[model samples]
Target: MKISDSFKSAIVEAICLLYILLFVYASVSKIIDFENFQVQLGQSPLLSAFAVPVSLGIPILELIIAFILLFPKFRYIGLMSSFGLMVMFTAYIFIMLYFSPFIPCSCGGILEKMSWNMHLVFNILLLMMAVCALLFFDKKSFFLRTKQFTVRLLLCTMISSVLIIILIFTFSEKIIHNENPFLRRYPPHPAEFSNAVRLKFNSYYLSGFADGRIYLGNYTTPAQIISFNSNLKDRKVHKIIFDPANTRFKVISWYVKGNYFYLLDGSIHKIFRGDIKTWKIDTELKDFPFFTRAIPIDSTTLVFRTNKGKKMTNTIGKFTNEQQVKVKYFEGLLQAQNEGVFDTDGVLMYSEELNKIVYLYYYRNGFVVADKNGKVENRGNTIDTIKHVNLKVSVLKNGTEYAISSPSITVNSSSTVYKNILFVRSQVKGRLENDQLWEKSFIIDVYDFRKNIYLYSFPIYHSSPAKKFSSFLATRTHIYALLGSDLVVYEIKNDLKKEMNSK
Candidate 1:
């Protein structure tokens, strides 16, 4: 039997209508993979020059138009939007195919879920549907009243698109610039800072110079003393400075600590004790963590943070059997909740008068404490435990006080040492030229939360032409400094070895 004319018309309309639904589904798929879609749009040769704004806005418009197209009443308005969008896509695909970068189906899971050949065929079929609507559907949809509405919607979308482009240009850089704020002073020259052991009653200072050199100074007469250096043999060091306050706080969280200097590598600790004239490597602790800062709470307990993503603690011991180095850790205590480590990656806050410190790590890990025993216990893990000292009070914030734990409770995965953070603000008066001659006047500030006060900031000017600067601070009274790879006595005296010899 021959098919009726009305039935044939209905069949054609149904097939054409499926394209509208498919278009809507595709638009939603793109929106779901919005990030990847934007990435693709930006890379697409069609809009690469003006890619950013288009990448951000086009998917929304496409989805809106696709939905409107499904209804016969608003079909004209939908066609207007689809026409503009399709023109852009056609241009994009042709350019990509011509130049031939060979895109491997980056349109998201939905588009890729269809086979590659099928995707191409489906796009062509959709284009044909749009054409058929333009030809036949245009007959009914193109009445004067409907045409007027469609034109107005297109005009508004074009105007809005231009405005979004302008806004993106005006403000996007500021957002990106904030992330790289330290591009100027960041990435100090590289120098090896490991294997630092404590030197008894010596004074040492280690600093990285604006010039490709490290400065090591030893003060003896309260300020004046001998100095030395260590030649790093041309390696890139990120940044360098003396321990912020010349104390145990230099090795915060997971840093290397000893009687001499503290060395904090990415995740390695090297504790050393030697004079600057004669170099020596003492104790090297690897893989523990290259902590940002660490301070000794007492003879037994230590607190610190990994230079990485976590804050940890390590408990000290008196050696039960003279075999294993006994230790425990508090994982995830100080969840770097402030400025998120970017603004203050290697910065510290130390207070002297309060005998306390509020150490801040990069990311959001920071701790506030009035004394050395400020720690937070997670689950069954005990953050801090004092031997002779009684548990007085452990406060989380200024308003609330909570108890941490009793003596000798079980702890795991905590760091015994944290990182030693350093913040140096360099101010120059005149125009700064190329980095070769660029000079930096260093002012250092540290926060010791155990003391609860911001300590003094000191200035470091170009002193002697440093041959090599490698020094470690054991304490305020003792220091081990290196000059040109040679060890020296860092004290307010004549010479360290000579004093030992003369005595």
Candidate 2:
């Protein structure tokens, strides 16, 4: 249908008036709630680096465009500017939906009530209006000389594309790294807790993993090793039989490797070796060094941590009966604070695949890696920022340790090493809202032991609000955690599993 020039002008005027009203309302609303607008922009995936300037400039530009559209003399230029701005907004929305790590909160005012999908539709409609206004205002600008308008639109799109690419390249690491603003990388229902069973005692802890089964050792019942299949089915308790008349020693520590288990009594300095298949002690070696913490490397060699008598200096060393290899390898590994005996205590883990020993401090945001001989290899930082043990300890006259102040734990609470990945349960919270998230769930920070870099973190929901996951064992497909007296198994998310396998 052929339309009159006067009717086309009227339609163009109405579109211009609508845009003016929209921009004016939006700009005024942003100015009234400027702080909130700026904060929301700071959380944006692409514009976080220039959040301050963008937050201040967007409203000003909107107001200027609205005023320009109100004047008939500059209406064409105003419509051109509106088309360009709407194109940029629409492109941003499209990229956010497709490429962004996560979507942030909405902009303030009326837009805040709309979802991102709805906002994208609204932007597209406004863009169509701008294009219609531009076409009606021009006669030769569209049909005869298609070259002019097409070139301008293409140029605007190219400019916006370049800007988005640069922002993504520059700020993606800021969003993915430990100091990230976005936290919802995985789904809320990513894992399902199953096969929860009550343990015989709260002191029954995960001793080792071997032969596709988990071994639970109790402190009270040291001779009993409870084994469960990977799926928490087929429970079997193996009782190690020893000759009673040979020697009497309390089992202070127990560990299991491929097909053998070791029981060490640090008080009597005796080591007992037994076959895991037969569950019988065959060899008893005496004159072993006293170690507070120990783990087996082979049937003949062991890695242990012992405290030196003077000044409570603790050191890590290896022990072998071949030539009495009781040499301290990690001397002065602990930084002495007020007291060094218990303040620098940490969990030790040995990875057979990497052949590296990892020492994760309970109070700090760092871990040390060394070879089997205790030679220092590399030291890496955890995601947290704490470096020192925040504790107050005093040594009494009788050489007993006393805590004057209860310390606040701010770093690695629990950690386990498997293959090339180190999974640490963090007590510290990263860049996330909801202060109660820490209380409601356990946050796991994953790191690459081979490359020494933090990969990612995920939340594991707790069955109860007050209960925290004390320890967890990671299998190929699931993670079994000892929560209070019950065991909760959670299947690892497929994406996380792929991430671990890829690295």
Top candidate, metric lDDT: 2
- The count of backbone overlaps in candidate 1 is 108
Q: What lDDT is reached at residue 476 by model 1?
A: 25
For residues 237-348, write the lDDT of model 1, one tens digit per residue. Answer: 1222233243242322112223223343333343322222222334333224345545433222334544333222222111111134434443333332222232223222
What are the Cα lDDT values of the candidates? 0.37, 0.73
TM-scores for every candidate against the unseen true structure:
0.30, 0.77
Name the regions of candidate 1 deviating beyond 4 angstroms.
Answer: 1-19, 27-67, 83-107, 112-140, 145-156, 165-278, 281-359, 362-503
